[model samples]
Each structure stands twice: as C-alpha cells, then as structure tokens.
Target chain A: MEELMDILQEFEPGVDFEHCTDLIDGKILNSLEILSLVAEIEDVFDITIPTVEIVPDNFNSAQAMWNMICRLQEEE
Target chain B: MTSYCSFPFLFLFLPAVIVVYQLMPEKKRPYVLLAASYLFFWLISGTLLVFLLFTTVSIYSIGKRLDREGEKRDALLKTAPRDEKKAIRQLCQKKQRRWLALGIFLQLGILLTIKYSGFFVENMNQLLKWQQIEPLIKVPQFVMPIGISFYTLQAFSYLTDVYRGVTKAEPKLSRLALYMSFFPGLMEGPICRYRDMAEQLSAGGKITYHQLTYGVQRILYGMIKKVVIADRLNPLVQELFDSGTAYDGGLMFVALFAFTCQEYMEFSGTMDVVIGTAQIFGIKMQENFERPFFSRTISEFWRRWHITLGTWFKDYIFYPVSMAGPMKKLTKNTRKSLGSYYSPLLAGTVALFCVWSLNGLWHGAGWNYIGFGMFHFMLIVLGNFVEPPVAWAAEKIGLNRDSVPWRIFQMLRTAFLVGMGEVIFRASSLHQGVQMLKTMLTSFTLGSVKNGTLFTLGIDRHDFLITGVALFLVLAVSILQERGIKIRDYIAGRKTPVRWMIYYSAVLFVVVFGAYGNGYLPIDPIYAGF
Candidate 1:
C-alpha cells in the first residue's frame, strides 16, 4: 500500500493519493497518467494489470490500486 | 419509420407495440420486445434484417465456445502441476483467440464491405489514375442496414467482454437479439453493454402510471427539442453549409454555430425520445449526453457529448492500444528520458491517433468526417501537451483555474473550438471545410448580420424568435440539470392542476410551434446517417 502511494505521488506530484479516493473519478489522473502509473506499478510489484482491471473501481484510490495489484499477484 | 417524430412511429407503431407488450404475460414480455424490434428492423431495412440475425447467431455461438474453453482451462488448472498449468492455459488461450478472431472478422467484415466499399474503390481508382493508368474500378453503392454501425459495435463489445470474462456468454438468443435490435437504439444508440441491459431485459417490469406519465413527458421534451429547435434550424444550416454562396463572416459564424446547435438538438433530442420510449416500457436506458456545452475542455466535451460512442472508443480502442505490447515498451523506454508527465504521452498519442481516425471514419465514409476526427484529436493532444505550461502561466498570473470566471472562459473557448469542428463535420468535403474556416477567419464584419443578411437564408424573424425561445427553455433546463436539480421530480411533486397545466402547455407548445407538417423537407435525425 505504501509502495502504491509512492507511485501515485510520482505520477501526480501533489495529489493526496493517501486520502483521494476519486483519483480516477475526479479526473486527477487522466488516461495517459493512468498508463504511466500502471506501467510503474507493474514494474515495482511484478504483476500484470490486464485491460479488464483498468476500470475506475481498481484505480480510483491508492487502496483500490493496491487491492488490484494484490489480486493480480494472487492470480499469478 | 421516417424518424421517431413521424406520425406512423408516434401514432401507430409505438403505441401498438406498447399495448401488445402490456397484454403479454410477464415472463413473455421480453419476447414481445424482441418481436417488435425485429419488426422495426424489417420495416426499415427489409431483408437486410438477415444481417442482424447473422451477428446475433455469430456472437452467441462464439461466446459459448469461448466459455467452453474457459471451463476446460479451469478444470485442467485444478489438476495440473504449477509449471504445467502455464502450458495448459496457453493452449486454451490459443483456441479462444482463434474463435474470438473469427468472430471479429465475421462481424467487422460485413460493416467494412457494406459501409466503406465505395469510398475504398473510388480512392483506389483515383490512385490508379494518378499513375498514368486508366481508372477502371467501379464504386459499389450499398444501402447500409439501419443501426448496423451501432449494433455492430455492441456486438463487438459483447464478444470482447465474453472473451475477457467481463460478461458471461448469454445462452439465450432472444435476449441477445433484443440487446442488438432494441427499436429505440436500433437506428442510433447509446451503445449498451450486455451487462447494463441484461437485468432490464429479464425483469420485464410493468409500466406503472408514474412510468407512463413520466415517459410521455420525456418524449414530449424530446419532441420540442427536435421539432421546435433542430428542425427550425435545418434550412438555414443547410444553406449556410451547402449553398455555394460566399457569405460574409457573420453568416459563416452563424453557419458554424447553427449546425452545431442543430446536430446537438437533433441527436440529444433523439436520445430523449429513445430513452423516454424505454422508460415507457419500464426499462431504463443509459444517457448519451450530459450538457456537453457546459464542458471546460475539448476532452471534457467529448466525455459529455455522444457519450456512449466516446466511451466505446476509449474502452475498446484507446485503452487497448495504450496497453498493447508495443505501447507498453514505448512507455517504458520514454520514462527514463522524458520523466513521468511526458513518458505516457508518446504512447497515448498513438492510441489517440487510432481512435480519432477510426472515429472520423466511423461517422461516414468521407474525408470531412476524418478531418473532424483529426480536428478534435489535435485539440485534445494540444491540450495535454500545453497543460504544464498553461498551469505554470496561470499560477504566475494568479489565475484560479477552478474559479467561476476562469471556468466560464474555458467553456467558451472549448465551445468555440467545438463549433469549428462542427463546421468541418457538416461540410461537403474536407476542402470545403478548410475554405469555410478560411473565409470565416479572413472576412470579419459584424455589420453584415444587422443589414438584413440573416433574413435572406431560408428562415424569417418569426422562425428565429421561436428557435431562440426554445433554445432558452433548453438552456434553463440544462442549467438546472447541471446543478443537480431534477426538473422532472420537481414537476412530479407539484399539485395535480399545476402538473397537468404544465403538461398541456408543453404539448400545445410543440403542437403549435413544431417545424413538422408538409413542406418541412423531412428533418433528418442527424446522427442516424452515421
């Protein structure tokens, strides 16, 4: 979870990823930024984020993203 | 069948379907909808209903096969060793891909051949002529089956979803057909995903008094939008756009703004009617618009307008392209040098390019549509590219990006940019669009608008007055919606006399002022052609 927050911070410098649940819904991270975040998370965590998992529910918050990464890891 | 506003559709066909639907047994209501949808398809496209049938069968069968492969893979995974599980999964994945590929080819092949064959052949012939060879290929003209473009995308989405395990394979054929051919969505669409409409189909809820009245109210609102505003703007828009007269800058700007207004009122109005019709049947359809004019940026504008199509491109094309293996590599390679902000852009721009090119072509087999797509593509890319600088400049100047004044300025700027794209969309050709923009920019004189220039097009001051009033009514409604106040609920809560009076007044307003009767040169529901 801390690792996920760190990655979100790198993509959007000042966003409160720790508290911002609307990161996806509020358009804080637009599509391209989401792409960058996805790639970085995959590298740091060693998990593949499939296109199906790229929905708002999985990326709307740091916790949501952490949940998705954990799930992908479990699947692997 | 001419349009939703046509007497036959409003008076005869729709009411008949509703009556029959209500009379049918609860469990059988969905089938009644299926029959009515097929009948509507038959009325418009005749034997071409076969195309819809073909796709319905294709998705059902392929989906089941994909599901079977999933089952086989899961079963094997439970028994196999960890190392062997990977191999088993790959083997099943190969089979699923083959089936999915076949489904895509079969579906898109028909759309490509019927919709784009003429454009391809004509362009090819021109290429051949340029090479000093006699052009010999004849362009084939095919009448596109109504809703083919819309349903094909829905069909594609369903198949892709099943393959991705986003949605399960729909075992029933009728339910799938109803999804593809729902009469309200048949001609143009909000492009429902199977999951979105699946529950509504199976539920077959009864149309209550509230649903009926509210549904009619929604339909009436749509009627006013289409007839009072869009239809009234039609001739003036057509003349300004298609008439070869080189009008002054005032008229050109009118042409620019007028077509955008007409397209919005017509398309969104159609959605109102479609959604309202769904409401009458106690099935809630997704909204295709959300006050697009209120948007503060080109990207935000697309998210609001023709919303389903925009999201369709985003989900199916944009994300896939961005996440494709090549793009993944591109993003990784760029990150080290360009840093976080700029790295993903290189890959994203590629995805945007594909989306826009296909989006433009999807509207029609014309270069102007492609230009319209690229026009927006450039705007969005430029917006992304300049964001950091713009933010820096804003902070330096003490401008609040989220303040009312700043937001208004952004909205107006976005509207101006969107209006120009509308001109390109409505132009006869890409060359014409460029010429119109050139003339609009170069020949500026506001005095021409006041000198009786407006009266000469096709409509008079009376027509202008009615459209203005109608537009304001829509604007008031939009403003309320944007503020999160539901006008329908407000009206619904009013006293019976007040509600009925408002309802009667609305009906009379449409009946008395609508631009429909004879001599009105059949108002084409604009997006239906696309």
Candidate 2:
C-alpha cells in the first residue's frame, strides 16, 4: 500500500488519491495520468492488467487499484 | 423526404409514427419503431437502407459471439485448477479481441470505402502528379449513405462496451437493430451507446399527457431556433462564403461569425427536435449542446458542444491511445527526463495529435476539414504550454483571473479563435480558405457596412431585425440555462393561461419571423452530410 501511494504521488503529486473515489469521473486523473499509473502498477506488482480492467471503477481510488493489483497478482 | 422541421415531417410523418407507436402493444412497439426508423432512413437515403441493415446484423453477430466467449471464460475459471485459470482466461480474451477487431474493421472499412475513397484517390493522384508519375488512381464517386459516420461510431461503441464488460451484449438482434437506427437520431446524432439507450428503447411504454405536451413544446422551441434564427441567416452566409474573396475583411468577419451562429442553431435545434421526439415515446435521449458559446476556452467549448462526440472520442480513441504501450513508455521516460509538471503533457500531446487528426478527418474527407482540426489542436496545445507563464504574469500583475471582466475577455478570445477555425471549416476548399483568410487579414474597410453593402448580401433591414430579436431571446435563455434555471420546467409550473400564452407566442414567433416559403431554400441539417 505504501508503495502504491508512492507511485500515485510520483505520477501526480498533491492529488488526494487515497480518498478520492471520483478520480476518473471528476477528471482528477486524466487519461495520461491514468496510463502512467497503470504502467507503474504493472511494473511494481509484476502483473499484466488487462485493458478491460483499466476502467474507472478499478482505478478511481487507491484501494480499488490496490485490490485490482492483488487480484491480478494472485491470478498470475 | 422532409426535414424534421418541414411541413410533411411536422404535420404528417411524425404524427403518423406517434399514433401508431402509442396505439401498439408494449411488446410490439419496438417493431413499430423499427419499421418507422427504416422508413425514415429509406426516405432520405433511398436504397441505402441496406447499409444500415448490414451494420445492424454484423454488430449483433459479433456481440453475441463475444458474449459467448465471455461466458465460456467465466465457466472455465470456475472449474479450472488455479494454475490453469490464467491461461484459459488469456486464451478466451485473445479470441474475444480478434472478434472485436474484426467487427471494428468491417464497420470502419465500409465507412472509409464509401465516404473517403474519393478523397484517398484524389490525394494519391496529386502526389503521383507532383512526382511526374502517371496518376494511376481514379477517384470513384459513391452515393454516400447518410448517417454512416454516426451509426458506425455507435456500432463500435456497442461492440467495445460489450468487450469491456461495461454492458452485456444485447442477445436480441431486433433490439440491437432498433437501437442503431432510432429515427430521431438517425440523421444527426447524440450518438447513443447501447448501455445508455438499449433498455429505454426496448421498453417502449405508454406516452403520458405530460410527456406529450413537453415533447411538443420542445419541438416548437427547436423550430423557433431553426426557422427564425438559423434559416434567416442562411442566405447571407451562403452569399458571403460562396464569393468570399470578393468581400472586404469586415464583411468577411461578419460572414464567418454568422456561419458559426447558423451552424450552432441548426445542429442544436435539430438535437432538440430529436430528443423531444424521443421523449414523446417515453425514451429520454442525451442532450448534445449546453450553451457552448458561454465557454471561456476552446477546450471547455468542446466539452459543451457536440458533447457526446467528444466523450466518445475520449473513451474510444483518446484513452486507448494514451494508455497504450507506447504512450505509457513515453510518459515514464518524460517524467524521469523532464520532471513531473510536463511529463503527462508530453504523453497527452501525442494522444491529442491522434484525436485531433482523426477528428478533422471525421468531419469530412477534405484538407479544409483537416485544417479545422489542426487549428483547434494548435490552440489547445498553445493554451496548455502557456498556462504556467500566464498564471505567473497574472500573479505578478495582481490581475484576478476570476474577475468578470477577465472572464468575459476569455470568452471573447475563445470565440474569436473559434470563429477563425469555422472560416476554414466552411470554406469551399483549402486554397479558397487560405485566400479568404488573406483577404481578411490584408483588407479592412468600414465603408462596406456604411455604403449598404451588408444589407445587399440577401438580408434586408426587416430580416436583420427579426434575427437580432430572436438572437437576443436565445441569448437571454442561454444565460438563464447557464445559471441552472430550467426554463421549460419553470414555464410548466406557471398558471394554465400563462403557460398557454408562452406556448402560443413561441409558435407565433416562428410562424411570423421564420425564413421559409418562396425565396428561402430549406438548408439541410449541416452535420447531416458529415
């Protein structure tokens, strides 16, 4: 979780990614930032997140992204 | 074939469709709608009904196949050992991706072959001639089907959503077909997604009195905007743009601005009628325009105008390209090499390039259209690049960016930029657009307006007065809407006499001030050809 927080902050500093659930819908994390986050998550967790899993629901909150990473890791 | 605002459509076709639709049983209402929609398309496109049918059948088949693959993958995951589950899922996804790709390619291929072949061949021949080689390619003219661009996008969205698991693949082909060819949106569209509209379309219910009245009132409002404001300006805009080089810069500016106004009224007015017509059937379609003129920036202007198209491109093209492997890698490298503030922008610029290029070509297969797209791209990119510097300057100068004067200035600036872009879009060709711009920049004379040249362009004083008054009313209503006041609902809450008076006046305004009858040619919906 700390690692994930670090990644989020590095991707987009000063965003309240831990608490904000409207990250995608509210346009907080724009398309480019989301892509950056996805690449970081893949590198750190060593799991390939499928394109379908790149939805707002999976990346809106830090916890959601963490959960997705863990689920993909387990599947791998 | 009559337009949505024409006498035949307003008095005859719509009434007939509504009566039949309302009288039919709930279960059979969809079929009635399907038939009506096909009739509408047939009337406009003649024998091109086959194209709509082709898209409908192909997308339905592909969606069903993808859904079965999804179901199979889930079932396998349930039964498979933990080690094999990943492999099984990957296999299934690969197969599904192939099917999705096929579906997209088929639709886009058909669109390109019909709509863009001439453009492609012409460009190729130009290049060949420039190289002193034989022009081997012949530009083949096809009677391009109407709404192919719109329906193709919707079809792709449907297939994409199903693949993404955002929406289930519609199992019933008939339901999918109706969703694709709904009459209200068949010509120019808000581009409904399967997930957003499928259930509402399938569940055709009884039309209540409120729905009926509201729908009729909305349609009347649309007619007022179209006939009174848009149609009235058509003659002047046409005359001005057709012989753009002949006019002085001042007159040319008026022509460009008028064309912009005419386009907004015509397109958004059509949307109002389309959405209103759908409302009478108890189906609420999405709103396309939200006072786009009020936007203070080109980017915000896009967010408000033809809103669904922007959203669609963001979802399908912008996001996918940004998040694709190359862009991801580029973002990472930029963040490390150039630091955080500019990294995302670097990646965004790349994706934006794709989006804008496609957006330009999507309008029409012309160099002028491409110029229109690139012009906007340049404005947006320059805005992004200059934001930090502008903010610093504002802070240094103690200028409150939020002040009303500053806001108004921003709005005007954006409007000026947009008007310039529209000149290129409305020009007959790229070379003509360049010549028009040269004329605008090199020459300026107030004498044209002073000497009655403005009035001679086809509109006299009476027409100007009517247009001005109607435009003022539109502006007032837009201001209210910007402030979140629902004019329709507010009027609905008034006393019966007051409400009826409002309704009657709206109808009367169109009938009295509208540019129709002998001298006026009904301008087809601007975006319909696109």
Candidate 3:
C-alpha cells in the first residue's frame, strides 16, 4: 500500500492523493500509466493479475485497488 | 436531407420512439433501441443497414471472444510450470495480438472500403495512366452510410480496450450493438467507451420530468449554437476562403478569423447536440470540449478541444510509441550519451509526429488535412521548445506565470495561435493554406482593412449583427462555465420562469436568425467527413 502511494506520487509530482477521486474518475491517468501502475503492483505484491479482474472498477478508486490487491494476494 | 433536419425523424419518428421506449418493459428496451437504430439507419441508407449490423455483430462477438480468451490465457499462465509459463505467456500474448489485429483490420478495412475506396482507386488510376498502363481500376461511387467512420472507430476503441483487458467485453450482443449505433454518438462522437455506456445501456430507467425538461433545454442550446452561430458564419467563411481572387490583405485576415470561428461553432455546436441527445437518452457522454479558446497554451488547447479524440490518440497511439520500441530505445540511448536534458524533447517530437500524422489521416484521405495536422504539430512542438527559455526570461524580468494579466495575455496568444491553425485546417487546399498564411503574414495595409471587402462575403449587416449577438451568447455561456458554474447545474437550480425564458429565447433565436430555411446551403457537419 505504501509502495502504491509512492508510485502514484512518482506519476503525479506534488499531487495530494487525498484529492484524487476526481482524477481517477476523469481518467486523467492514461492506459500506459495504468499499465505501469499494474506492473508496480504486480511486482510489489508478487501476485499474477488475472486479465478478467483488470477492469476500471478494480482500479478506479485507491480503496478499490487496495481491496483488489488484498483479494488477489489472499487467493494466491 | 441531413439526418438532424429530416422532418419525419425529428417530428414523427423520434417522438414515437421515445414514448414507446419509455413504455416498454425493462428487458425489452434494448430490443426497442436496436430496432429503432436499425430503422433510423434504413431511413438514411436503406440496405446499408446490413453493413451497420455486420459491423456491430462482428465487433460484439469479437470483443466477447477476446475477453474469454484473455481469461483462458491468464488461467494457463497461472497453472503452467515456470519454464512453460514463459512460453505460454508469449504464446498467449501472440494470440491476443492476432485477435486484436484481426478486429482492428476488419473494422479499419470496412471504414476504408466505404470511405476511401473511390479516392484511392481514382488516385491509383491516375498513377497508372501516368505510367502508360491502361486504367484497371474504376472509382466506385457509393454514398457512404452516415456515421460509418464514427461508429467504426467507436467499435474499434471498445474492442481495443477489451483486448488490453482494461474493459470487460459486454456480454449481451444487443446491448453492445445498441451502444455502437446509438444515434447521437453515431455521427460524431465523444466516442463512447463500453465501461461508460454499459450501465446506461442495461438500465431502462424511465425518463423523469426533470430529465425531459433538461434534455429539451440542452437540445435548444445546441440548436442555437448550430443554427444561429455556426450556419450564419458559414457563407462568410466559404466566400472568403474559397473566394480566392476576391480580396487582398486585411479582408483575407478577417476571412481567416471568420473561418476559425465558423469551424468552432459548427463542430462544438454539433457536439452540444450530440451530448444533449445522449442526455435525453439518459446516457452521459464525455464532454469533447471545454471553452477551448480560453486555453493559455497550445498544448492546453488540444487537451480541452475535441478532448476524446485527442486523449484517444494520446493513450492508444502516443504513449505506446513513446514508452516502447524504437523511440524508447532512442530516449534511453540519448539520456545515456547526452544526459537527460534533451531526451524529453526528442521523444516529444517523435510522439508528436506520430500523433499529427494519425490526426491528419483521421480527418480524411487528404493532403490538406495532413498539412493541417503537421502545421499545428510544428506550432505546439515549437511552443514546448520555447517554453523553458521564455519562462527563464520571464523570471529574470520578474514576470509571473501565475499573474492574472500574464494569464490573460497567454490566453489571447494561444487563441491567436489556434485561429492561425484553423485557417490552415479550414482552407480548401495546402496551396490555399500557404497563400492565406503568406498574405496574413506579409500584407499589412491599413487601407485594406478600411475597405468594404470584409463585408462583401455574402453576409449582410443584419447577419453581422446577429453574429455579434450570438458570439456574446456563446461567450456568456463559456464565461459561466469558466467560473466553474456548470450551465446544467445553474439551470437546474433556476426558477421555472427564468429557465423557461432561457429555453424560449434559445428556440426563438435559432428560428429567427438560423441560416437553414431558404438561402442557406445546409453546411454539412464538419466532422462527418472524418
């Protein structure tokens, strides 16, 4: 979770994560950014992400993504 | 008749469909929409309805299959041994790529055959004749089914997302098909993505009283923008731009500016209609525009204007090229050899080239469009190159990027830059674009400005008066939006009297000043050509 926050910070320098609900909703993060984030998450958690679970809802909110990562790890 | 202007569809067909749609059972609504969409296409292109159906079904099935295959591949990756997993992953990736390529090629092939075949055939014939070979190809004449390019691109984007595993393939074929053929987004898009529209498609929510009122108001705003402002500015622009031999320096400059305004109103106004129509259907499409003219930078202008298409390219084209393959290699090598100082600029230039070339091709099979794209690309790239130096000088001189006056100055500068690009874009040809640019740059006679040639472009004093008022109306709406007071939200809060008054005025202004009735040759929606 700390690592994900660090990744988000790297993408958006000086952006406050608390105010980023709209940023995620607006799809301001392009697909490549999403891919990079997914790569980071995969590496950190060491879980294989199933393709079916990669939809917007899974990644649209920081909380949702945290939940997804937790769930993926629990299943593993 | 243009689909928007068709009497039967607007007055008879649409109203009947809306009522029937609301009354239908929730499960039956998709069927109702599907039937209506098919009927709508039939009205326009009769048997070209088959092509539309073919496109929808192929994409829908392909999307579902890709999703399933992707899942299967992932499962295989999980279960396979480590050494085998690597090969399996590669194989799965290859399979996915092939499926995606097939889907894209099928969609793009349909689009090209329908849209560009005649152009290609004619050009090929010309080349062959020049080579002293008998012309083997004949230009086939086909009335391109309305919305083919728009819907096809929408389908392609949806499938691509599914392939990328970013969006799920919509399960129901009917829902997927309806999304593609949804009338509002069909012609020109804030190109609907599956994830955005999927819930809207399945939920057969009955229209509320407020939704109806809001929809009507939205439609009225679109009508006023299109009919009053865009259509009014059309002839003046056409006469000036195509009237090549008529006027000299200053009149030509005004003409160029006129073209800029005309293109904006037409395109954005048409989008207002598209978005409003989607609103009526209880689907919220992405806003393709913000008050683009107010952008303080060229890059910012593109971000705000035709935002969906721009973002689509940035995601699907620019980012991939920038972060992968030859360009990525170049960036890494450059950084290693010469430090990181120039790497971003080099990458930006390459990415911009890809984006602009694709942007130009997306417009049409035309050299002029390519020129238009490259022209803006050069301007934007130049803007980026100069930014650091300009910021440094400003800092040295104590100018601030944050100051209100400086922001206003930058906004005006960006607007002028955009207007210049519009001149090149809206010109008849590359030669005309060059001529217009050269004249605008070199010829600065005060006498030319004082002359009546500016007024002679078919629009009279009355037209100019109406245009001025319309411009104010647009500016006022834009200012409200700029201040973060969304028009819809404000209107939603307004008293009924005030709201109704606004609605009535929109309708009245459109009816009174609109150039569509008699003397106007209906200016086709510009993006329709794409």
Candidate 4:
C-alpha cells in the first residue's frame, strides 16, 4: 500500500490517494496517469496488468490498486 | 427513410414500429426491434445490408468458439498436474489468441476492402507514376454500406471483450445481431461495447406515457438543432470553405467557426434523438457527448466528445498497443533513466501514433482526415508532455488555475484547437486545409465580419439572427444541464398542460425556423457518410 501510494504521488503530487476514492471519477488519475501507474506497478510488483483489469474500480484509490496488484500476483 | 429526422421516419416508420413493438409479447419484442433495424439498414444502404449481416454472423460464431476454447482450457487445467497447469494454460491461450486474430481480421476484412481499397489503389497508382512507370491499376471507386464504420467498431469491441473475459460469448445469435443492428446506434455510433449492450438490447418493456412524451420531446430538440441551426448555417459554411481564398481571413474564420458549430449541433443532436428513441424502449444507451466545448484542454475535450470512440480507442488501441509486451518492456527500460513521468509517455507516444493514424483513416480515406488525426495527436501529446511544466509555470506566475476566468480561457483555447482540427477535417483536401490555415493566421482581420460582407454568401442578417437566437436557447439548456439539472425530468414533473404547452412550443419553433422545404437544402447527417 505504501509503495502504491508513493508511485501515485509521483504522477499527481498533491493528490491524497489514501482518502480519495474517486481518483478516476474525480479525474485525478486520468488515462495517461492510469497508464503510467500500470507500467510502474508492473515494474515494481512483477505482475502483468491485463487490459481487462484496468477498469476504474481497480484503480480508484490506493487500496483498490493494492488489491488489484495482490490479485494479479495471486493469479500469477 | 433516408434519415432519422425525416418526416417519413419520424411520423410513419418509427410510430409503426413502436405500435408493433408494444403489441408484441414481451418475449418477442426484441425480435421486432431487430427486424425493424434490419429494414432500416436496408432502406438506407440497399443490398449493402449483407455486409452488416456478414459481420454479425462472423462475430457471433467467433464469440462462441472463444467460449468453447475457454471451457476446453479450464477442463484441461482441472485435470493437469499443478506443475503442468501453467503450461497447458499458455498453450490454450495461444490458440485462443489465434482465433481472436482471425475473428478481428474477418470482421475488419470486409470493412477494409469495401471502404478503403479504392483509396489504396489510387495512392498506389500515384506512387507508381512518381516512379516513372505506367499506372497499371485502375482507380476503383466503391460505395460503403451505411453504418459500416460504426458497426465494425462495435463488432471489434465485442470480439476483444469476449477474448478478455470481460463479456461472455453470447450464445444467442439474435442477441448479438440485435447489438450490431440496433438502428439508433447503427448510423453514427457511440460505439457501444457488448458488455454494455448485451442485456440492454434484450430488455423488453412497453413504452409508457412518460417514455413516449420524453422520447418525443428529446427527438424534437434534436430535430430543431439539425434543421434550425446546423442546416441553416450549411450554405455559408459551404460557400466559405469551397472558396475561402476569395474572402478575407475574417470570413475564413467564419467558415471555421460555422462548420464547427454545425458539426457539433448535427452530431450531438443526432445523438439526442438516438438516445431518446432508445429511451422509449426502456433501454438506457450511453451518451456520446457531454458538452465538449466546456472542456479545459484538447485531451479533456476529447474525453467529453464522442466519448465512446475515445474509450474504444483507449481500451482496444491505446492501452493494448502501449502496454503490449514490447511496449511495456520499453517502458520498463526507459523508466531506469527517464523515470515514471516520461517513460510511459515514450510507449504512449508510439501507441498514440498508431491510434491517430487509424483514427484518421477511420474517418475517411482522405489525406485531410489523416492530417486532422495527426493534428490532434500532436496536441494531445504536447498537452501530456507539457502538463508538469505548465503547472510549474502557472505556480511561478501565481495563477489560480481553478479560477472561472482561467478555466474559461482554457475552454476557449481548447475550443480553438478543436476548431482548427475541424478546419482540417472539413477541408476538401490537405493542400486546401493548409492554405486555409495559413490564410487564417496571416490575414486574420475581422473587417469582413464588421462590414456588411457576411450577409452576401448565403445567409442574410435574418437567418443569422434566427440561428443566434436558436443557439442561445441551446446554450441556456446546456448550461442548465451542466449544472446537474435534468431538463427532461424537470419537464416531466411539470403540470400536464404546462408540459404540453412547452412541447407544442418546441415543435412550433422547429416547424417555423427549420432550414427546409423553401429554398433551403437540409444538410444530410454529416457523420452518416463516415
């Protein structure tokens, strides 16, 4: 979770990823940012982020992203 | 009927279809809609409807094949030892991918050959001539089936979704067929995905009084926009664009702005009617527009405009291309030095180039459309690349980026970018597009607009006044809608007489001011050609 938070802050410096649930809905993490985040997560966690798993629900908050990362890792 | 807005369609065909749809048993209603949709396609495109049928049959079969492959893989995985399970999965996955590829090729094959082969042949002939050789191939001209471009994308989305396990392979052929042939979305699509439409297409319900009233109201509003504003401005737009060099840059600017207005009104207006028609059947279709002009940047504008296409590209083109094994590997390698901010952009830029290239060709086989695509590509790339620096600069200048004035300025800037791109998109050729652009930059003076020169082209002061007043009404409605006010719901809640009065007034407005039937040529639905 901390690692995910650190990565998200790099894309949007002022965004409070921990508390905010509408990261996607509120336009904090847009498609470009989401792309960047996906690449960064895959690099750090060594799990492929499939296109099917790139939905807003999977990346709307830090915990959500962390959850996705864990699930992808478990599947691998 | 040739158009959804045509009297024959609105007055006769649609009403007849609705009456039949409501009278049919709920279990049989979807078939009625599907049959009507096919008839609508046939009415417009003649025997070209076969192409749509070919797409539907191919996708439906391929989708089921994918489902079987998945089941086979699961069965194998169940029996295999844990050590060999991954290997079996990988092997099965390779086969599924092959099937997916074939399905995509088959779906796009007909579209590519029918829609773009002529352009390819013509370009090839040009290249051969440039090499001092005889042009061997005759430049073949072809007619595209109406909705080929729109329905093909929907088919593509369906195949990919099934492969990705996002949507199950629909076993029922009729459901898949209905998804592809739903007449409202057939012509100028919002390019719906299968997962979005699969259940909605089959959800049968009767048209209630509210549904009927609201649907008719929304359809009327769309008709007004098409006839009263978009069609009204068509002559001036045509006159200026057809021979803009004869006028000052001021008039060229008029051409740009007028075409932009016409395009938005026509496309989005059609969407209103499409969504409204679907609403009558109790199926909630996705919206294609969200007041795009209010966006603060080109990127934001695209997100708001023709939203489904943007999402389709994001899902199928941008993400997949950029995040493919090779691109992801590149992003990883670059991240070691270029870091997070720029690394994905490297891969993203490459993917965006592909998307825009295809997007340009997707609009038409014209070089200007490709140029239009390239123009937006540059803008979006530049916009992404500059975000951090622009933020830093804004902070340095102590600018409140969120202020209304700042936002409005941003919106205007975005609108200008869109207008310039539309100038390219609407131009007859690339050279003319460039020439008009150069004129706009170099000889930009509003003298023509200030003088009485505006009245001469096609529209007079009276026409301009009507369009302006009509536009103001649209603006007022958009503003209200933007503030989270649902105009339809608001009207629905009104007293019966009041609602009737408002509806009657709307119909009267269109009847009186619509640009048709008296020396006015109603411009065809613009995107229908694409």
Best by DockQ: 1
Task: Give me the runs in candidate 1 sitting further than 4 Å from their true place.
Answer: A9-28
Best by TM-score: 1
lDDT string, candidate 3, B193-239, tens digits:
78788888777777777667777677667777777877888888888
Provide C-alpha RMSD values for all models, in order: 1.6, 2.2, 3.9, 1.7
Residue B96 in candidate 4, Cα distance off native in Å? 0.6
Kindly give the number of clashing pairs for every candidate.
0, 0, 0, 0
Q: B1-530, model 4: which lDDT tens digit per residue?
A: 76778888888989999999999999999999999999999998899888888889998999898889899998987787777877887887888899899999998888888888999998898899899898469877778899888999999988888887778999899999999999888889878888888888898887898788778888999988888999999989989988957888888888889999999999999998898898888877899999999999988898899999888888889888887889888888887798778888988999999989988998998899999999999999999899989999999999999999999999999998899999999999998988888898899998988888999889999999999999999999999989999998998898989988998999899999999886788788888888
Candidate 4 residue spans exceeding 4 A from truth? A9-22, A61-64
Steric clash pairs (candidate 4): none
Better of 2 and 3 by DockQ: 2
**Per-residue accuracy of model 2 over B99-123 as CA lDDT, tens digit each:** 9999999999999999899999999
Instruction: Order the candidates by DockQ, highest first.
Output: 1, 4, 2, 3
Q: Find the 10 residues in a row with the least total lDDT in model 4 chain B.
A: B134-143
Checking candidate 1 for backbone clashes, the offending pairs are: none
Tens digits of per-residue lDDT, candidate 1, B1-530, equal 87887788989999999899888889999988999999999998999999999999999999999999998999998988877876897799899989999999999999999999999999899899889788469889998888889999999999988888788899888888888899988888989999899879777777789888888899999999998999988889888887633788778889988888898999899899999999999888889999999999999999899889988898899999999988988998888898888889999999999999999999999999999999999999999999999999999999899999989999999999999999999899998988888888888678657898787788889989999999999999999999999999999999999999999999999999999777566468677787
Displacement of residue B475 (Cα, Å) in model 4 is 1.1
B280: Cα error in model 4, Å: 0.6
Model 2's alpha-carbon lDDT is: 0.88
Candidate 3, position B419, lDDT: 79
